[model samples]
Target: MAEKVLMKGNEAIAEAAIAAGCRHYFGYPITPQTEIAAYMAKRMPKIGGVFLQAESEVSAVNMVIGAASAGVRVMTSSSSPGISLKSEGLSYMAGCDLPALIVNVQRGGPGLGGIQPSQSDYFQATRGGGHGDYHMLVLAPNSVQEMAQLTIQGFALAEKYRMPCMLLADGTMGQMMEPVELPDSAPEMAEKPWALTGTGLSRKHNIINSLSLTPDELERWNIDRYARYAKVEADEVMYEEYLTEDADVCVVGYGIAARVARNAVNAARAKGIKAGMFRPITLWPFPKAALNKLATTCRAFISVELSMGQLIEDVELAIRCSRPVTLCNRTGGMIPSPEQVLASIEEAAAKLN
Candidate 1:
């Protein structure tokens, strides 16, 4: 039987990670996402799991890497600045093909930006945040309920693909409370044949390192990783559309921005404006197909975001620039109100007409 619980999005993620068989967690506390670490600290040891607060984000992610290399389900989480610090570990994890879950409850960016919720990391998560040509599976959850679901799904996908899966969220979603039906504890997965556990008599010693001395070897590694990414792009894209059928305008958004956009769509509908929403759940393997289809029907697209035009560019690319994509956004900790969204929709509709 499933249990309904009222939980903050960050708390739900911590609980869901435990239910998903993640017994190892390492993280540093950062704004708007600190509840996740706090929840883990309280709940992890009670379940006989280990939760460690490392000295810094770099060490925290490296700890996750160490745990994952030992074949344990491991996770780490942070906001934007902390994630920036962890990018070195992220790149190394990618190179080693380590299965880990790293949640970035995104906030404003560049430097020691504000603690307010922001989706400014779209480029960072989609295009490799760190150096080197590698990708992380980036999942964006628009609601607290989705925060739980995607965190569990993220672990499974990471293990299956031997890659890091990131749950990219923002402050609004992280701090908001919502009802969620928790998933049951997943069955213990069988041993991974490819994991870097001690190699016995059957094979040679396994070493996990990102450094490649030769240029040819490095180039070949890049090609191989990209091939894996291409497969993910084909199989892993996820999104949601509301009132898209017969709509003249589509609002593109994800994370909390999607929820606000939905409210605006509802307001637009009440006024007889054919406005709809197209939300990309997997921000990295973006929902290009759905957006392209909407382009054929919708006269214009409005991108609602917590940052200025980060996701708007992707919408433009997906639609092949056949239609204009307008930006409706707030930055530096400000959230766009439903009224603002409604106004944006009205403006877009007028422009299209």
Candidate 2:
């Protein structure tokens, strides 16, 4: 049996990235996620890995782009605003078809809102924060264990798709401690013939760039990238369904909000409300087909989130408006309590009768 160690979510992500054969980490410090940088700084030197705290978030992400272009497992972490700073670099990586891991341990924000946890970055993450027709694989971890597990998975997925992956966590998950079993060995990485390694006078040199002055060429690149995204959408949708077999009302959430919604699901059950919980593990390439299928049986959905009705939009779209969806949320660093979510579920139930 694998031994379990107690770790905070941020620390778990750092350790897991190292275990996943990530030898390069470049990031700037920010509230709610600085522990990730601190952990990497302490461990990387001993293992012959590189951990450089860049001067700014912009520089950190561009550093990731450089490492990723050379075909290495690289990662960077920050909070909401820091992620926004990295958005252009993210688009560049996507345009260049380079793979790397980006972590966002979210804090409140449109503009440095607060240092407390918030999921308001849903639109930012899933919609590709930068100006481009591209997408990043976004994984939301609900617990410290998932934090570690998803970090490893994010690296693998990024490499496989040749694009960026974001681990979308919030402050509560970043600071919370739990027992977690980490992997003992790193997974084998795929060869990157497309990487810009020096030719050494043996073959043609590889070039990595996102610029295409020709309109037709740029259009083709966008179309091709989206084709890859279509494959990802088809194959990589991950979600969790709980007590949904006979549910009339479904509670939808992700990350920290999902954790609270699970408790509310149990409470709603006790109160004779057929409420189940649907947690989206992947925010992008969302489990639309699964939710649409559930809409056939479930009469309504309650989207519980730490943002003001952001996740509810996706819920309604997923169900194709076949069923009504309500939002139960708190924004600006406040979390919705289990009782609050349960009240929303009860309200949905009452309306169904």
Candidate 3:
């Protein structure tokens, strides 16, 4: 049997990145997510991989862009404020069609907010974080184990789509410790024929860029990218439907909040409420089809979140007004209690009476 070791979520993610063939890690120090960089700094040199502590989050993300363009697997991590600083670089990577992994171990924020857990970066991750019509592949993990698993998978998804993939984790998930089994070997990387490695008389030099000075050229690029996004939406939507098949009250959540809602759902079921949870594993894809199917049978929805009701909008949009959606959440680093989510579920069920 594979050994299961206790590890912090941040450390687990760093080890997982290495296991995913990520040879370069560029990051600046930030709370909640600093451990990921620390782990990389400790291990990357020993493994012959690069670990660069950049001057700022912006610099770190750009460093990832440069390394990724050179046909190497690379990653960067930060918290909410740091992610905000890296937004421009993220957009640029999307435009250039670079495959890279980004981890935002989220903290409370609008500005330089608290160093505690928060899910407020949902908008930044699910929507286009920076300018233009682009979306990063976003994965939300509910546990420390899933943090490692998703980090491994996120790298594959990014390489598959030739886009940046983000693990949208909260500070609690980053700092929390749990048992996880490490991968025995790194996943093999696919060749990047278009990578900007030196051609050296074998072939023509490759140019990796997101710039087009001509209007028509830029329009064509945008259209082509949108077509790829449409394909991604079709093929990559992922979710977990817990007791939703016969549910009357559907509770929607993701990441740490999903873990909380799972317990609330069990409690609701014990109390004779037909409660369930729909967890969005892939946030950008949003699991709309599954939610729409359940909306046909469910009476109401309760969105459990660790932010000021950020996931509620997506839930409402997914159900398309077929069922009323209620918000149960806490913001500014406060985690929602299972009892609070259970109360929301019961209240939604009572609305039918």
Candidate 4:
């Protein structure tokens, strides 16, 4: 067994990306996620990797596109506002069907809100963020271990589907410290035949671009890309169900919110409230099937979030509004306490009677 080491969540993500065979990292430092760039800067050179801090988030993400075009394992990290600047690059990567890892360690909201933790970017992440008909695989990690584990998984899933992947974590998850077991070996990378490597007169030249002049041609490309997304939806939906065998009230959450919900569920359970927790690990390919199934048995649901009721919308959509869903959330970098969630759970239980 690999020995566990105590490390901050941001550092774990950096180390895990390295373990996943990422050799190129281009990012600009931002609050809550700067540790990722700092770690990469100090360690990338010693391990024959490249870590370049660009002048701006826009420049860094464009650099990611360049590296990905060469069919190399590449990554970039940023916070909420920084991610906004990279939205254009994200769309271009999706249009080109380029695979790369992007990390968003979220902080407070709409415009340079605050440096405190927030899940306000949930919609931005799961909705593809930029202009286009596309989606990126979004992974939410609650713990330092998951922060590391999901980084490796994000790289594999992105390469498999030939699209960008985002690690959506909150400021708390980025700054929190915990024990994690790093990968024992580096992962094997996939071959990219379409890469823009020189032909050496051995074959036809390769082209990597997102441009399509014809409207019908662009339509077909979007359709085909969605077909691949459907496959991912079918095969890659990941989530966790806790103490839900006969739960009457279900609490839904993800990332740091899920961590808090777990504690609330425990408290409710001790009080004989029969509460359970459902946590989505993959926000894009949401565990819709699983959540819909839970709706059949659970009478009501409470969405715990660090945003103003963002995750609740998905819960309602997943269950098709069959069961009553309520929101228990805090915005502007505020977090819901266990006692608060317990009160919501109790209220839900009472209403079911």
Better of 1 and 2 by TM-score: 2
The worst-scoring run of ten residues by lDDT in candidate 1 lies at 187-196
Which lDDT values do the candidates have, in the order given? Answer: 0.90, 0.94, 0.92, 0.94
The CA lDDT at 210 in model 3 is: 91
- Which of the two, 2 or 3, has more TM-score? 2
Q: Which ten residues in a row have the lowest lDDT in candidate 4?
A: 183-192
Over 4 Å off in model 2, which ranges?
A: none
The TM-score of candidate 4 is 0.99
RMSD for all candidates, in order, please: 1.5, 1.1, 1.1, 1.1
What is the C-alpha lDDT profile of model 2 across 2-37, one tens digit per residue? 499999999999999999999999999999999999
For model 4, what is the alpha-carbon lDDT of residue 124? 93
Expressed as tens digits, the lDDT of each residue in 53-117 for candidate 1 is: 99999999999988888889999999999999999999999998888999999888779898988
Off by over 4 Å in 4: none
Error (Å) of candidate 2 at residue 348 is: 0.4
Candidate with the larger lDDT of 1 and 3: 3
Q: In each prediction, how many residue pairs overlap at the backbone (N, C-alpha, C within less than 3 A)? A: 0, 0, 0, 0
Give, for candidate 3, the lowest lDDT window spanning 10 residues: 182-191
Error of 1 at 193 (Å): 1.7
Question: How does each model score on TM-score?
Answer: 0.96, 0.98, 0.98, 0.99
Tens digit of per-residue lDDT, candidate 3, span 252-299: 999999999999999999999999999999998888888898888988
